[model samples]
Target: MTVLVVAAIAYLTLALILVYAIDNLVALFFPDAHSAMPLNFPTLEKMMAASRKYYRK
Candidate 1:
């Protein structure tokens, strides 16, 4: 049915958006959170890299 198809599409869109938002937030606030993981995947490294450094003087 057309209604079912539309609902499915909307659900998928929302799911994608949710994942993107979470990834951005994690990258922003907890970039090194995954650094200790044993796996050395390139994609994981990029995702875990921080956009900016924090320092105290």
Candidate 2:
């Protein structure tokens, strides 16, 4: 049981690290692309940006 728990945690940690690295690499190569956001929410970044702009108070 302990071994299985440790293995699961290790697997998840490695997967998260891989995802973070891939995301960084994609951003580095495709600065203009929106691969991080889904197509249905095309303007998600813009909307978040606008919200942050207005919430600066």
Tell me each candidate's TM-score: 0.53, 0.55
Q: Which pairs, if any, clash in model 2?
A: none
lDDT of 2 by residue, 3-57 (tens): 9999999999999999999999998987975466564565877888899999995
- How high is the lDDT of residue 27 in model 1? 87
| Candidate 1: regions farther than 4 A off | 32-57
Clashes of 2: 0
Q: Of the candidates shown, which would achieve the greatest lDDT relative to the real structure?
A: 2
The C-alpha lDDT values of all candidates are 0.78, 0.88
Best by TM-score: 2
Could you tell me which 10 consecutive residues in candidate 1 have the lowest summed lDDT? 48-57
